[model samples]
Target: MNLLFLTFTFPLIGWLLLSFSRGKWSENLSALIGVGSVGLSALTTAFLIYQFNVNPPEGGVYTQVLWQWMSVDGFAPSFTLYLDGLSLTMLGVVTGVGFLIHLFASWYMRGEDGYSRFFSYTNLFITSMLFLVLGDNLLFLYFGWEGVGLCSYLLIGFYYSNRNNGNAALKAFIVTRIGDVFMAIGLFLLFQHLGTLNIQELMVLAPQKLVAGDTWLWWATLMLLGGAVGKSAQLPLQTWLADAMAGPTPVSALIHAATMVTAGVYLIARTHGLFLLTPEILELVGIVGAVTLVLAGFAALVQTDIKRILAYSTMSQIGYMFLALGVGAWDAAIFHLMTHAFFKALLFLASGAVIVACHHEQNIFKMGGLWKKLPLAYASFIVGGAALAALPFVTAGFYSKDEILWEAFASGHTGLLYAGLVGAFMTSLYTFRLIFIAFHGEAKTEAHAGHGISHWLPLGVLIVLSTFIGALISPPLAGVLPESFGHAGGEAKHSLELSSGLIAIAGIALAAVLFLGKRRFVSAVANSGPGKLLSAWWFAAWGFDWLYDKIFVQPYLLITRLLGNDPINSSIGLIPRLVRLGNSLMSRTETGNLRWYSASVAGGAVLLLALLLILN
Candidate 1:
């Protein structure tokens, strides 16, 4: 417990130091402190994992309370930390991959003007992300949730010198706020019904205490899902994440891939018991996840910017995890989440290295045939691509992603299973397509030729990890979950050896044909009638973003315009107009001398008395 406190404390300390010493410290020292604090946290997490493994706590969950945070009537929300297999997995990923991204940023952000400021924001991000995963209660989770949101806004707009970056940050904040609103409502509903925000308590109480299939349960689950969708960048709320590429690469890697975005997945898994009460809502979750996956995959295909492609890819991958969660494969969802952090972070960092080497050029068309120049980057990118493509047997992505597909299939949601499979093929194609076009084709432009050793070292570490981590979860991470939840064995069936392996091979084959074999043929098709449809499919992300823009953004903009011009501005002006009119009327009344005023008053009284006598 002490160590857990220290893990969060160090990052806060780093934030404080960097904030106070802003402009006082050298860039190198500031970067070290910022990254070093996260590194320390990562070490602490390692220790926690070890301790938990050795003790093997009953129900595989550990809860520690710091103090009573809030209590009213019978409801209580505590300041606490919950450690379990699920949370430990998230902690390892956040701190481990996050630390690497920070280190990479130290080099990638070198010589930048806001270097110290960047590190400060990074430290703050780490602290908030830790709080998010570590928090034992919903209110505390909300705190961490908003903390990450704030940090994202600050860091996304880190280059506030650019108006565009500032706008991007604003967009991100506004979009996620929509989801946060729903989540807050859901939290309120939970506390009202269950009388506690402690996750462990809620999980225990939900199965027996709360009435299953109630309308309120459905509403609560849906509201929570809405928040998750927004935070995870799924479907309608996903536009902000693509635009969030306006941030620096390392920031994108951390927020989009490793930490902030995954909060939604954690939320769902943490409250799995709540979701289980509403089967319809669970199906809705699966559908949303599937649709998001396919839509975002298409978006990735059309994007020309290196980071935007990865941004959309992150959305797509997260959709897969959500789908797993929707089908009651909570453990599988988390397993994918863990593997995803390694490969996705690797891809982003490698791309950052490429961008830095190319003098900040991000257009892949401007890039080609640099495999020899940056072999390390090339290798790292391939490793990540392999994982993303889910090439059979070898990559960590295969283990997790295949498990998701298998679970979806066995869960008896045929439509969702089909969509997920299609998404797998699309994922395979676009991922390697990026790799082939950027690294394998002829050199399109002359840029900075190669990366420094620092670039390759981190990439190497991630590659090694991505290659091996899948085996840890491959046998099945959830043998105990069903027993703990009192569910029947084999409720969710998966075939690791046969069905998953075949689908993975099919995905790889499709990618190879489209990207590697007959490349010109593929390009020609993209130019032809059917190819145009495919390209268009990719461009509009099958119109998901456009649909959302029309439904939400356009109407909001129109309302804003009307309010700005007529209601808000006119009302403000009316106050002054009324004041001026009162002054004008008073000026008329204030005319003249005291004798004239007395005479007027006497005449009025005499007339009133005369009228009264006539009436009588």
Candidate 2:
């Protein structure tokens, strides 16, 4: 047996079991099934990774075809598994990080009202993401892509009783759907021109078949980028992720932190060949990434809610990955993705512990002096923050980001490099802002509870992985990618790395001074006119939500109210009204009156005879 399907199959089994077991089975058993399915999948995937390393596939690719999906008029795609370095990276991240998050959730959701439901949704989420990366063809990938979107809606709205959460979920679904439509159009165009939707074939033939500067290729790739933008929460499609904190913290860590938000990067990486066919769209990817990262970083700065800060942070980090992809630094992008998953998940999970300890209080300003009470979580957060800050050679983020910065510099994208540097500064400042406020001040609220192995273990593991995993994995990860990956710069590499490292350090130092040491400077800046305006703008996500409401939403609602019912729908109502009139007229003519009936028949006969006379 190929055994790849087992990754999704086991999780599907668990999700189904947990779905029905709610209120019918013991909580402990439910927890086991929920966690065990993903755990087993993780283990199996690890074995597969080991096997892949030991005997790498020929041409660094493997495909397992389950069956032919369609053959009408020779348009055939299949239920196939496209296993390669890229899919392998995603699989490891999804299964591995997902399993850990599930473990953490087992503790986090303990004694909650819908614990089983949470696990069921979480399991299904993992299954969907797996299918997304594992699929062999564009159509199959779209199935998984839509699957994750549905799962995001369900999980984000897991607390259906809360109206805000429900709204947030709906917002996510509707916004992402915009990108999905563009992607569908793109796929249709590609299939229409190329006559195939197979991933491998597209990768092999796209560059050759599609000439340079082809308008069709540019439009098609741009459309695909739309889908990536929506799913990954880049730029205009990014307004939903912060509100998505309406869901559980585990979901924040699992879906938003590690996997779902990175879907855009993965899509671009997987289809790099197609993107290469249109450098215009490729440059746009770089530009979008640069702008989004900076925007999200600004949004993260003034956030009061700890989870929302992480939410913004996730968006910003994915922006970095996008930047890397745009610069033709594919390996650098994936490296950052893996490292970001580890640290970001660690941050969110550790935040969960803080929330649980503080009686679910999420305001970092209200939290104070947790250094003693939540020592493990405190340390774990420090590790996550350090990695997030990319503290030189000590953390995984440093190496991953160093590669991107050098690549950006080498590719002559100095403006994007500058943007990356600025984004890094803001990332550090926001991260440490929460840290200093939450852990340094006197305790404003008491945290009396301390968690055991279930909480601390996952946090500890993620903390360790966040610091070391990227460096260890980068070498082999590079090999698995395309030939363009991991190219070394002559002498600029060292200088570039040093400059980026100092920029990161400077960001940390500035945060320490402003937030930790000198508070009055911050107050002075806040009172300034420009500062106030910028703060208000960034806090409102650059007012995209407000602009969208005015431009798109209000008009829609007004139109609906005016035309949604009765008179507006009278076009449809016309048929029934006309039918009633015809029935009434016929009935009136037939009202037990043979004279009226004979006159009507005579008129008809006269008309027929007149027509015959005219013809003769």
Candidate 3:
């Protein structure tokens, strides 16, 4: 009945309706339900935002306890909803932009055999992500976390008949589970120390209750970071996201770019109180995030598959968000998360348009001069790509990314700032590299012959949003926190303000020269020493996956074989051989049937008689 309840319930209702009517509902009706549900939820979120502005909650925190969900010995985990500026931002992104993506997907996935199924998964993903951001307690957050993971696996493997899709889904789920194990342990430790999973209560009590620099606290924080790293696709755990491109492009737009992948950054931001108490862990997070950002950016550069490049870019961009969080730029990180959801989703969906128009061809080399055939997609791609490259003032990427880099610089983490800069330069190179190679060059293949009004419409909508959303968030986000939290301030400084703007321009210019202006020269260089290395660096993602394969996968397989064959079989075989030998020795006594039986019986009687005589 409450607005928050409506915010959570409507999409679920749509999910149920579509699920029940999967066989009966027409594709158009199904699409409407799928998109409409999230749209209504977004509307509800807008209403809540308005209501919150009219009467802000105490200390910017809002709580609505629905019920006591469960209780154990001296422990209670309640089912409750929380609304704060943080949650409000996430709600808008998840439900609002999510609504737009769903609308796009309706057209994108129109004639697919699993139309209703895809929408069902999308709705479920939205519900889970909403619950994740809005939940008042850690238990429910974990519930939502697992829910999204399940949904990701399902959606990623949507085309289950394909072996590669199934494998990618499995890899994603399994790899993330490794991080979840650490997260679960961390959660238990938190409960043990604090005796509650309520996030607000934790925030209030954690600083006082937790001893600063405590080893156990550091361990717990690090463990939690592992989960965040996996969910957000940071180092060592980032491979799954790049591989997840095997899924449908819309799925990539929703999960990788917009909703699911950001969960890690959200978790760290939500638990800032806890992380702030553990500086060592925070530094570790920053270092890991920096490494991942640079690494993934390079990976994105050489990827020929349109979706794979975007996938790596998503990982790399999330690394920036993590870097912000790691360096105490919590608000900045979340701000990036919001802005990223807009433009990255736009990018992925636009790329999907290209793929669709190209008759499902994804190789950038196979595409050229598509700007004329799909002008809307080209515009959206450019907008998204510019934002990704963090081109100067007013772009969504510029505002959010510049804020992150500024925070990193101010945080006194010079190494992180440098890595971020390098990543920025590379981001521009690869983004425009794709743009030039795919859209600007001479037609490499026949123009995709099919044109539909439905296709271009979504691209146009996303392009408008990508270009404008950055400015809307700047003022409010700058003022979201109090001075005591160390965030009160002068206007948030953009890294690309003036000097930084020139630096950004230089990077863009370099990309233009290499990828667009001097393609033949660049191509020749790509075949040369340093350029070959750079290309290879991008192609193999600096051999991170190969190193992992050698160090972890091969060793694991070897151990598996050893355990399965040698040690286990040898142990089992020893017992079986001993049993066989004993049987063989005993079988000799049973030879010749009746004669042997009589001799044995007589021998036993004589022995018993002799013993009795001796005792007497």
How far is 38's C-alpha from truth in model 2 (Å)?
0.2
- By lDDT, the best candidate is 2
User: lDDT (0-100) at residue 56 of candidate 3?
Assistant: 74
**Which candidate number maximizes TM-score?**
2
What is candidate 1's lDDT per residue for 60-148, written digit by digit as tens?
76677788876777666777888767777788888888888988888898888888889889888888988888898888999999999
Query: Candidate 3's residue-wise lDDT over 1-616, tens digit each?
Result: 1578788788888888878875578898898888889889989988888877888777776788889988779787887998778888888888877887887788788789889888888898999998899898999999889989998999889999999999999989998888898899999888888888888788888888778887777888888998998888898788789888888888999987668999998898888878888988988888888999888887887889999998888988998988888788877788788888878988998888888888899999888888998777888888999888888875788877877787777767879988998888888888888988899777876655334555566566667667756547642333343211224334444323554556666777877787774478878888899988888877887787788889998999998977776876789799989999999999888777898799899999999999999999
lDDT against the true structure, per candidate, is 0.82, 0.87, 0.82
Residue 439, candidate 1: C-alpha displacement in angstroms: 0.4
Error of 1 at 409 (Å): 3.0
Better of 2 and 3 by TM-score: 2
Better of 1 and 2 by TM-score: 2
Window of ten residues with lowest summed lDDT in model 3:
480-489
Off by over 4 Å in 1: 57-59, 449-454, 473-480, 483-519, 529-534, 564-578, 582-616
Instruction: Flag clash pairs in model 2.
Output: none
How many clashes show up in model 1?
0
